[model samples]
Target: MTTPHNPLCPTHHGGRCPAPAPATLLFLHGMGATARSWDPVVRRLPATAHTLAYDQRGHGHSAFGRRPPTGLAQLGDDLARVLTHPSDCFPGPMVLVGHSAGGIAIMHCAATHPHLFGTRVTGAALISTTAGRLDPTCGLRAPAGPALARLFLHLTRSRTPVSSLLLHLMTTTRWPLYGRTAPRPTRRACSAMIRSTPPATLDALLRRLSTHDGPALTALTRVPVLIAVGADDRLTPRPHSRALAQLLPHAHLVEVAGAGHVLPLEAPDLLAHHLRRLLPPE
Candidate 1:
């Protein structure tokens, strides 16, 4: 079934903004994250640039029907639908900002619809994302040790029962394991966000992440792209972001020193500073 035209707004909770048409920015959240995740960063954007942050299907307030497809192709279709909807509330040459999986979605969309880059999407920002897998041999490996790597793999491959247990462990006790490395406030915020996400959805998304190799880096080469990563991010790692920047001849790589996986939260001001420079004038 097609996603409903009246899909739940991503900011339905405490951040919803009901401004009129001409939204200058379309913000996409990563897997297991809702639009709320952008709250800290969006507030830092220029007030002139209206923002539309929303949850993807099967996550947040959006419909969770039949565990929506994980392919970036499907995500591209959804994005196109959102932008080309009959209502068409967004203005011309919008800036698409995505984090993690959301960044992957943007890259897929741009690659599939190359014309949208300069013609429609003025620019794109990919925060804490990778062009390919996290394999050590691939030269983009995270700092995750063998034990953590084994746990991650097991959690990804486990069935319902083991997966459920793993999810609880990660969400409850292990979440802080990652967050502790982030700024204290950012860590707390990210912890809450992670806890809010459903284990099943998280597991499903993680599985997709393992095999998700799309045209992100290749697509960014043709567009004005910004690739940012945290210096301390163990998930995507700084090296992956560097590799992605190298692949994109014109991409700007911003490394947030001392920041972790949740750079948006850890250094929202810094991120906003870069965003202001990259986004077109209103």
Candidate 2:
């Protein structure tokens, strides 16, 4: 479907414009993160680039009234809406840039709606994410698995009040687990985003992450993709990124030494430099 001439503007101050109409760059943040997480990276982009970053449903400034769907495919749908919705602020070709869970969302969108990409999506950057869950071998175990499971069951089967209480605990209490290794500033930012999200959305989304098949690496062959990982990323290790890179026909893999999963904050300049190389000049 052709993207609308005008799209929904979710930012507090409408949307910022990139002078000279540079290619649109849509940034998707990791699970439990808000669009503000992209501030550092966005600031480094070429001044002429138009940009749009929104709280995905449950995350930032977006509507918290409805519970965000849990499945990755549903998240993909949300992304499609953002890109092609009639009232969306973004127009023309877009280069999708996603970090961690957001990267997975982008992959699902690209795979299911290849036509939407067309010539408009020049490339994609998947940072610190894997194609599938690593429950069995990744060594990073869910700390409160039992509590999480109980909360999930309650939310899915119980009343909104009970579920809401459980959700608050799950989202607020478990946020530290998600970014346990992130640096102090990054951790604070991530925590704030999670706290801002609705309990129902956080509960459902986390449950989805366990079973979500982010992207079938092999399916990315048609698009120009880049997979980068921190060499020391214990959560979604470097090996996972390597495995994903191997599946893409037109993919390039970059390993950032000593960098962890939070490369965007940990090494903004390095990440920006790579993005500059991947993005075409205006």
Candidate 3:
């Protein structure tokens, strides 16, 4: 008989991170992804940088959450809880790194929990994300992408099979979810995580994201920010990142050429280089 696997112990590759390091890095992933998604990116970081990349609620090891999945506020709460906890692992300043929906969660947390961000969050990186307007645009040539997304959310209110179909569409590298050079392993990893995720989790989050706005961004204007996006991304295009940069007075924008939505995996080295800039010399 096959043994059951533990969802909490995510399948992130690379050696374990050392504790009590001077700097702490918290990595958050987007929808349909897990902590393992940061494997390639984290491996490229400095050896001394302590990092924790956890599966956000409902994606990998995390649960679908008890609250209604209206928007990223719930996930933002999760981040706040972890960072504010009285744990040595989270002590000192933190560099927040988020991609896509993960970015949205970080933004929500920053916007809503100013005390947490002002005290602990020293730097942030928002990749391929927007404060709002996702529903109006950001689809793959689908003018009604937002409406279609809403329809899917309604169809898969609770744990359902609709997410599986959506997963399959995004699994293939040939699909627009990734860049042309994105490794097959990256695609495979995303497929596995999405297959295991509940439809309710994705549906609720996406539904809430439809109404996402950036009033919270007002809190992050003073924090150093990096806005990166794939030049060819059909999902959350460069325009969204550019708009976010404008909101952040200390934000810098970087556009990766020929890359698509999967910026972390497709351009790990480039992403790492940018992340390194956020840290002081070892």
Candidate 4:
């Protein structure tokens, strides 16, 4: 199958200059993270592949996005904007890689713009994401789970001190890295990207996740999909991945052992290995 040239892509100068790489990959970072979070995985890919990663709204370099309610609808629009812009998109259909909330963002885009799946996107990798009902008490302790989930829910409305404390705890105390600590550079990169995001971003993300429509994700059925998760993941537990896999049998599901919520940082090479498999042969 021949992919139509982007026409506007600089390298697509007809018969005048050599066209750019045939395959393009776009990376979307998770909530409270910048595009830099995918650096580890991106770096491991072959240099010839066209790759792009950018800060999501209110995270890192991107703006706070006019205001808070940047829910799935707005995020879906944002993804479409990035993909259609001449400067943002590559010359070929894209293999979309997204993590955590970023995964939902990709799904939202696919859900709303089904046409893009065939014309602009080749495949998608949904990493550490959930479709809906994200408030499952998967990782918390048995007896106190409901209370903690309720507390987390109440704090989702941007109760500053609690929200800040919860985020701080999540970053420092929770299982950001599993089995062992990530490399120094990876740790530093994750810290810088995550720390730069404001409290309101996290608040809006939780609210959206809580209310997202699961049926919307059916739009992804039009293309090949990959669902990858960490074996020891507590946040979006492995079962979530399993359920999503069942939803799309055409999709592949992979669980990286000894990994947690942050697979991009925890196992960059491993994650990149999976990504490379989806690429077209050179």
On lDDT, the leading prediction is: 3
Residue 166 deviation, candidate 1, in Å?
6.4
lDDT of 2 by residue, 64-83 (tens): 44445556666677788777
> Which residue pairs in model 3 clash with each other?
70-208
Question: What TM-score against the true fold does each predicted structure earn?
Answer: 0.81, 0.76, 0.84, 0.85
Which predicted model would earn the best TM-score?
Answer: 4
| Candidates in descending TM-score order | 4, 3, 1, 2
The residue pairs that clash in candidate 2, if any, are: 7-87, 7-88, 7-89, 8-87, 8-88, 8-89
Prediction 4 TM-score vs. true:
0.85
On TM-score, the stronger of 1 and 2 is: 1
Q: Candidates 2 and 4: which is better by lDDT?
A: 4
Q: Name the runs in model 4 displaced over 4 angstroms.
A: 1-19, 87-89, 136-138, 157-162, 176-188
Residue 47 CA error for candidate 3 (Å)?
A: 1.1
**Clash totals for all candidate models:** 0, 6, 1, 0
lDDT of each: 0.66, 0.65, 0.72, 0.71
Q: What is the C-alpha RMSD of each candidate to the true structure, in Å?
A: 4.3, 5.2, 4.5, 5.4
Model 3 per-residue lDDT tens digits across residues 109-175 = 9877988665688788898777887643346445567676656656555455455556657765456
Q: What lDDT tens digits, residue by residue, belong to model 4 across residues 1-282?
A: 011222234222332433455567778788877766777787788766667666777776677656853675666677788787765335677888989878888888987887888677888899987777665455667676788777666665555434474466555754533334455665566666666678777777766676675646666877778899888887787888898898888898998887777888888888888888778786
Can you write out model 1's per-residue Cα lDDT over 7-47, one digit (the tens) per residue? Answer: 33423323454455343667777765677778788788775
Cα displacement (Å) at residue 11, model 3 = 11
Those runs of model 3 whose alpha carbons end farther than 4 Å from true positions after fitting are: 1-19, 65-70, 135-165
